[model samples]
Target: SRILLQDTSAVPTSPWTHFVMMAGSTLRKVKSRSWKKQRHFRLLEDGMTIWYKSRWAGKGHSTFSVTEVEAVREGHQSEVLLSIAEEFPADLCFTLVFHGRQGNLDLVADSPEEAQAWIQGVRKLIHKVQTMDEKERLDQWVWDWFQKADKNKDGKMNFKEVRKLLKMMNVDMNEDHALHLFTMADKSESGSLEIEQFVHFYKILTQRDEVWKVFQDYSGDGEKLMLEELENFLMMGQQEGERSAQLAQELIDSYEPSESGAMSLDGFQKYLCSQEGSIFKPEQRDLHQDMSQPLSHYFISSSHNTYLLEDQLRGQSSLEAYIQALKRGCRCVEVDCWDGSDGEPIVYHGHTLTSKILFKDVISTVKEYAFKASDFPVILSLENHCGVEQQTIMAEHLSQILGDMLLTTVLDGQVPQQLPSPQELKGKILLKAKKIGGLEDCIDETLTDEVSDEEEANGDAESPSAEDPPAESLTENDKVKPRKSKSKLSKELSDLVLYCKSVHFHGFEQARLHGKCYEMSSFSESKAKRLAKEAGTDFVQYNTRQLSRIYPSGLRTDSSNYNPQDMWNVGCQIVALNFQTAGLEMDLSDGLFRQNGGCGYVLKPDFMRDGNTQFSPEKPEERPDYKPLRLSIQVISGQQLPKVNQKEGSIVDPLVRVEIYGVPQDQAKEETSHINNNGFNPVWNETLNFILHTPELTLVRFVVEDYDKASRNDFIGQFTLPFTCIQAGYRHIHLLSKDGTPIPPSSIFVNISISELT
Candidate 1:
């Protein structure tokens, strides 16, 4: 192989010396007097240049001469160099080798695994001689090769000559073997090796005594190192290694693949290799794709169980729940965001503040959780329940905090100005619109209200009365009616489909998670068609139970029917993740099914081994019942509503209370009251049905007639209702009394109505 030199030996005595690297045969000796001016030498080939300078030479006033001491090999060039250093350095001091110099050593490895193993072995050798105590033995061994390989007594070895010597010695003629020699010989790599080439190559191959010694220095006593230990080592090295970890971080931060911030393990491994070497041959590297190959990495519990962040993270107070979710094996973390007035993003599940949780340190906690990226490298699919502007602000905040490290997607809103642009992160930002419709809208407001009255009547409104029974379920053999409709799936969801395509366009690994099931049918058709037509990136996601049920006939995963994988190559892709748990029964007491619980299920680790694994039995344990509904009322109008306090004349909206009639006489007296003038002003709004009272009242009364009829659907019984209104705030009013109570009046009653402020 050809070698390049950065400095010339004649400059050794100068304050700062330089080495002139060129084709071994083209190098000329520098005149002693010209040493001061020859601080550096460069080798040029095909308009590319490799420079060698005094800076590359060790701390002493010493140098080496580059010369062609061997004949060129059939497809390789070899060089030889004579060193005149005061003392041998701890490590091998040679230049780099270039592919152009190899000529014909173009033996390629079909798989990346083969290439990685071969390269790692060579790197180990270089490290051993650098930090160990066998410097003298290493130096002597190399020098001996130099003398033995100078076949013509010309003090230089050429490429062809080196190959001839290897053949003469019966060396194994393999790509790995050839690479070892080439790397040692062409350090500066001016495309040809000189005396130094043969010297380094021979020592690396023939120095049996020092080979094992080098391995011992870097090995962990023949045991594999823990990941944490390796991580620490990597971090430390990045901080203080030859190239510095900062450079690697910068490169990673600046990278923008069209689709995602998450790099596949395979892709990242190649990146790591490239950072160390001059070139990265991903095809030849043994890349680990285990972590990123799954379509979906989320773990679901078959049972209704609630898992709290406190239960995970093993007790790291500062860690966010989302971060803990990753530790718990949840590959997809769903975050519900509502825009705040200040443009800040808030995470909460309910539609209003009374049902919300506000963490004072939410932002900082999120940052900590976000730092543990890659655990869920796909989209942090954010559901926006507020205004579009607020959603945009949230996206902006996320981008500012995460930079290029987070693959964030906000659903149902236009992107905000503050967030990193798709241009900035190289398309890391993803947007998916919500899909709503079909059976979702079937649960109308009246139906929801009827659904909520089961406890009151001590009976459920039966599904489709016997006289007018429910319609027969449709089947595959049945004829279906055609209807004109747009998929209820929102633009945000559509954007996700597009985003995945974009990721593939930019050559990145991609994934997604679809939780809603209402528009499944239409979504499946349109998204699949669009992805096939537009975005060509692969989609790896865990389908909901509903989706899987629809897939066989609806999605057609078989290649014969739909070549989803082909879509990836063509710029569209789809991969369904299996999530069938045939036998795991979860405890309802585990809180998984709580209205706003963190996780909707829980399972043992063994159950999560594979998609096909069944859950084992749990020991008998205590169970808890906590699903009882809690009720409170709000005033949308009248005097009980939110007050406009103008000290001189404070005005408040009216109060509306729905009182239940049944319990003790004392309780009835405590709860009932007569509507005094202060409360029965007669001014009303649709939301004000109960009696309104002044702020000074201890209690007031409402005469509600025929209240019993409200308790039953399709029933005609009616009873009087009476209510007491105290000076409680709008939110404190009674919407429903968990335990039925009595009222004062015997004939009066009231009606309830839903209200919207605007």
Candidate 2:
């Protein structure tokens, strides 16, 4: 095995670090209580991977890398571990949580000391992996592949093993060319190469010709890029403008840099692949947008059924879900309340088998994580299904648990003509629920109010009947009524609703004449899409003053999501989707909110934010200041994509698809033809073009899928970014898994061109 560091002699070896590695132990691997089985597990000699096998199976062992683990949880942190709490002591149990929706591995140690040794040992390895530099990380990635390719476990790879490794890495190479590189790296007639030789082979194989071409264009000579050449490249090639010289010096010092202010081809590649070289503008990744506008003038990062970790009907309701959502910069989260078996109100899907959590617990979670991701306000969109008595209890919990974090009274002691800014409401939790009338209607002592708008508030006038939703391929159970008929509001809870008051969305004209800036309406996806289609200009105009929320349809029982960009195109602010579900829908939502400091709010374009704006999703071209852009993307190559198939001999044939989501005319996709038997480093020099109207609302999604003829293409990885954030230059797009988590080192190199469409 290859050493992770250059100097191993200087490092001291601790007893606890190797306790699990040197002396493998038998731990009880658990899923359900009925499925607990003893397994032999140990960390490998490389200290980067874990090997485990069922005690009963002679040669059926499985291995996963330490880098794959997102975190390590203790005791009953997971549902599976919680289920078997009675059988195992809390101190003796732990769970390994993998990244990107992979099921967790729950285990029970024979003793607390053994559990601690395993937990601490694994965590130490994880920390070391996390702190590695990009170059070191790349080295780790290569080592992982070497481990996988050395099938005989002889600590060396023969030509046959190297050839198979090429296929496993998703590379298709000519036999003679592969042999030439292999022989050169081997440097001996042994015909068997060790770990160092494999690393050398990878370096020779991955010489990025495309990046070298651009480097040569700017460099006086291809050997190195001096200060002047780098400055010019940043100015002309990367649009760095006035900061080009200073940024060039910074890049040179940061990446494979030199004190002499010169950058080699490798250093140049490193700079471009770094966050500074990403197609996304680094400035937009901070709090750059003006945040003082009224709440309705921005798009909010939101989640529907924020308490559910899985599907609605039977998923577990967890406080962790709320924490996850808030930590991901979700400024708005839905809480479906119900009358619990006890006096306290509980949160869960009303008419489903989903587990329940105490409402107070949810409130505590909200207070803790509301400002963790962003100091902006968090709207707790409450769907009240409880009686007046429990609703009062809910109010008490909200007041006591959230304390000062809850916004109980209106700012300025009275409702204003317009809503408050996210800047003004920072660190506060705003309640979004049915209120009696207006703020004046709420009396401190006399709190109960009549329920008058349930019918209208329940569904938009144009919303397809819940009983007959738009055609969606879903299980019957997904249609389970998520709430009860609207109940009267408790004065205590009603007072907490200062800004986001749920009301019926009447026609556009009615709202224009009588709408309160503090008033907001929730629309099912179908209704929102219909309104966006029928009244695109009006929808955009109305959103400027009052807030509009678009949620997934009731038919999404599987917790599926609709495209949020459609609603965003019409300037809808709170276009909520199932954060628990991962796909193109959530990708677009994450992409939009990913910028502006990830503060959970993105200011809409100037045209969309103006009260009298003529911007319309339907006729974007007709709007003033409609600078349509033609985007051409040259899909270069994919690096280190995750394997789609787990089987030993199954290599992937991948294809890249570039998709645009915006107004009707702007929504299109073009794809590259599949490359057969390659997933390691697939290349496709194909250019895809998109003409984008409403560029402010447009999102470009790059999807890499393993092509299959007999079945649906298997998803490899995807990346989504708003067109407005895209930088025109040679860039690297780091790809994410289906669940929107980074699959490290899996990225695509692309050449971007954006120009005026005229």
Candidate 3:
């Protein structure tokens, strides 16, 4: 039969329905937290199973269609099709869609001569599919569908018949999608698809089927289940048969002391509270019954599909409550920290929140909490809500309390020459660049005035935690004018580079820099390169838009994208020792790092940090909300959590909100306890694997649990982690699962080493 191709242009009436049917029976559903995407899809009745993705080493490709073919035969079929297409004559042309962004390919072969050229192009496509192992899996599935469309029991399929067959099979199978599949499949332009064509089409349908199944499973009975339903379901199999009845009676007895014979949800929950049988007990269930523990590895990249949690611990004080919250499994934590003008560090994240309490009181309160600093496992980002001096003072104070658990980060040259602890060098504190308005101009002033006073008085000029610089002193001429504030660009940049250089000079891993600037676009690539060369720094930060301008350009010899006239504009290499870019995008092209010849950008860690901005009333009506000091952190479990303790192929837990700063230390400390479905599992004894990814903390004590294999010799012994930012190496460790797998632990120790790179 002669084939006729037709194109249709309307949204599929039942995309989900059609997708489910096409994916096949095995796949359960297509579930994600992001908006779903739809593209033109084809429904080929041809017996050929289309291969879309690869699976396994060599099943040749996993065929999803009911049709079966020998592995050796399929391999030879693939070869023959590719070889014949190279010389077979065929006509090829593409049709432009009016107002359409994507052009449709139309290969018109009126005679054998033109058909031959078309076949050559087809050969290239076949060869490409053969070379990709993943594509093999896809090809096999497509072939299956083609086999089914061969209604005459013949080995070949024509589009005219295939289209009719798809309509009967409940697939829209319109002309455009069908013709696209056919054109790509028919290498010889004989206007007919041999068995190979069927194979490729089958693969495409199979994947659609799999994804459809997932969507249905997640949709669940066409009803949106409530939280209560989910909770009850989790307790379903916990207590079975007579034992369940006995527990129920016990619960009633505890609450119905007065013998009402009826109980409320609260009463029922309370009365049934036996450690051995309580439904709320962690051992009773996993996080949620429907959500199984993820088996994938760490999430090394960021995307819209990723999940983000909200800050829950808004107001609370009981350290116990905080600990319980942590046990609840949150990946992020925040705490209010203060630098008591006395150069003492206090754990508080706000200016107003701690106004009533002395910094020392905050410290003393933190000491009373049951959990030590080591118990918390998250990157602690601080906001210098307190002035820059206090932030520095607090850093010093924290350096002492945290010891090896702190990580230090300095942008350019803001840090001092010597720090007290080797743990500081380990990667605990970040000497981030705090760009003052017009900070560049303020540098000389900050150095000549602030630095001079501090040096002369050894930073004793003002109380390290002085509240406000006396508002009256801020009136225009008191120091530097607001508009005159400079970038602090050169100093901060140089400080980061110099610090990295100094640390590296000591034969240690180069210390990293946690660079920050509101206007990242202003942070040019040339400046960054110079900083890298001068200071030997690692890790730089950029917002989305800024990164696009600096993404490397591989071949800009004479392209409009770059100026070939300037060598610096062409073949630029933007290396991110440990780079991450966040914020707004100028365009989609900006987000494609690979296209620009650069590694991808990492999403900002959804963690808590201290934030401070002094606001002035420019006008009477411009008054803003007087927000007390506010600080928060992000926590993850198996999804957002950085790779720390994990099985070889298991997924990294999510980043949840386990704790927060600005709250009382006890409250902040308490948030970490209730994680991983209650009583923490001490199976993976591993430290956070990618410390450099978070260049903020100066010292870190990674508390991972090792499955107790009943062996005393479970430790992996001590090792060292050397980074570019810190010259001295931080001690590395493996708190392995008793069996050697990395897992969560009750607690562990980490020391931050901070010193000049050299």
Per-prediction TM-score: 0.21, 0.90, 0.20
Where does candidate 2 stray beyond 4 Å?
1-15, 30-37, 74-90, 257-260, 443-487, 646-650, 709-711
Q: What is the descending TM-score order?
A: 2, 1, 3
Candidates' C-alpha lDDT: 0.27, 0.82, 0.27
lDDT of 3 at 475: 40
Poorly placed runs, candidate 1 (over 4 Å): 1-319, 341-343, 351-367, 371-378, 408-758
Per-residue CA lDDT of model 1 for 460-547, tens digit only, reads 1111112211112333222132222211222222222222211001011111232232111112323444433333212212121111
| Predicted candidate 2 versus true structure: per-residue lDDT over 1-758, tens digit per residue | 00001111122436965876657889999977799899999888677888999887988999998888866777776656767888898899988867665667889999998887877777777778777877888888888889877877888999899988887776777899999999999977699888888899899998878788889999887899999999999888887789999988888889955566699998998887778788788888889988898998899999999999999889988876786778789999989888988798999887789998888878876776688779999999998877889999998988888889888878887658888999999888898887776765653444445655442243322232363333233344433333445446676677777788887665677688988888888888887787788888988999999998888878788999998888988899998888889888988988988899989999998998889998877888798677888899998888878888877678888899999998898999999999888777778989998888778778889999999999999999998888889988789999898898888788899988888876
Superior by TM-score: candidate 1 or candidate 3:
1
Cα-lDDT of candidate 2? 0.82
Determine which window of 10 residues in candidate 1 has minimal summed lDDT.
Answer: 581-590
lDDT of 3 by residue, 1-758 (tens): 01111122122234443343244222101112231122222223332332322233344433322122111111101111222333322132211111111111222233433333323322332334334332343344334434555667677878886665454332443479778877777778888777765555543432322223322333345232223332332234232333444544554555443454543433432222222321112222221121111101000111110010111122212222222222222112223444455655444323222122233332222333212222322222222335455554554445555454333333243533221221223222222222323234333444322322211211111112323242223443433332222211223322322111200011102111332221121112343333333322121211111111132121211111221111111111122110111111111112222111111211221121001111111111122332222122111211011233333222222111111111111123212222332111112212222212222211112222212335321121111111211211111132222211222111121222222221
Q: Measured by TM-score, how close is model 3 to the native structure?
A: 0.20
Which residue window of length 10 is worst by lDDT in model 2?
1-10
Give the Å shift of residue 543 in candidate 3: 4.1
Cα misplacement distance, residue 752 of candidate 3 (Å): 46
